[model samples]
Target: MRCAHCHEDNDLGLKPPPPKLQGVMRKGKMPSRAVATDQSVAQTVLAGKGKMPSFAGRFTEEQMRALIAYLRTDMPLPQQ
Candidate 1:
């Protein structure tokens, strides 16, 4: 399933609830570790881990950078 599927409303009742990503960028407390660097987080998104599936080719380089940048911000990305 997609990230929004679990993160959006976040009432799916799945075991091991998916993380709420609203402030993950500012928090730097991803399930993996503290002080998550942009490059390392990008690697996790691209490679996936455990239950999360890989998205290796789903995004262009530009798009990937944009995603990372969005996650790095303290504010929520403005609505599309």
Candidate 2:
């Protein structure tokens, strides 16, 4: 797995930190939720918000979809 933003190849066993959103949770911080499918994730990636920058210009629609698919299965769950 690699970082979608940085493109650094992360070891398969290593887990990445969760994305935090201020004011979205009662505690003032929230972890990003999954989008259910690769396509949905790609759309969200293209239409970024908050701390997530849009990938519209950086990657094509097909590349975004591939990235999302990598995130869905290869990336580890957030730490507890």
Candidate 3:
């Protein structure tokens, strides 16, 4: 998990870990308290928000789709 909120330890005295993202898609809350759609989440991942960095131009369309799918379910990651 590249997302620091989900994988990294806060041993360096950073803010506590972010909320778990297990049902963020179904609950419509992610990156913040605001509601978000799939398109919105993709946009956020691409454009970034707050401390999160943008991933624009970093992934192919298929990779982006696969990442989103993984976030929404337990699907395996698409091969590069």
lDDT by residue for model 3 over 1-80, one digit each (tens)? 45533324333344555444566776677858777677887888799877667889987889778667767883322322
Whose lDDT is higher: candidate 1's or candidate 2's? 1
Q: Which ten residues in a row have the lowest lDDT in candidate 3?
A: 4-13
Model 1 lDDT tens row, 1-80: 24566555445676787666667777767766645677777888899877767889987799888777777775544432
Error (Å) of candidate 3 at residue 23 is 1.2
lDDT of 2 by residue, 1-80 (tens): 22322233223333553342222222322234543455555555677755456767878666666655545454543332
Model 3 TM-score?
Answer: 0.67
**What are the TM-scores, per candidate, against the unseen true structure?**
0.73, 0.45, 0.67
Per-residue lDDT, model 2, residue 16, is: 52
Measured with C-alpha atoms, the lDDT of residue 69 in candidate 3 is 76
Model 2 clash count equals: 0
- Quote the lDDT for 79 in model 3: 28
- For TM-score, candidate 1 versus 2, the one ahead is 1
Candidate 2 Cα outliers beyond 4 Å, as residue runs: 1-31, 76-80
Q: lDDT score of model 1?
A: 0.70
Q: Which stretches of candidate 3 lie over 4 Å from their true place?
A: 4-13, 74-80
Candidate 1 Cα misplacement greater than 4 A, ranges: 10-13, 76-80
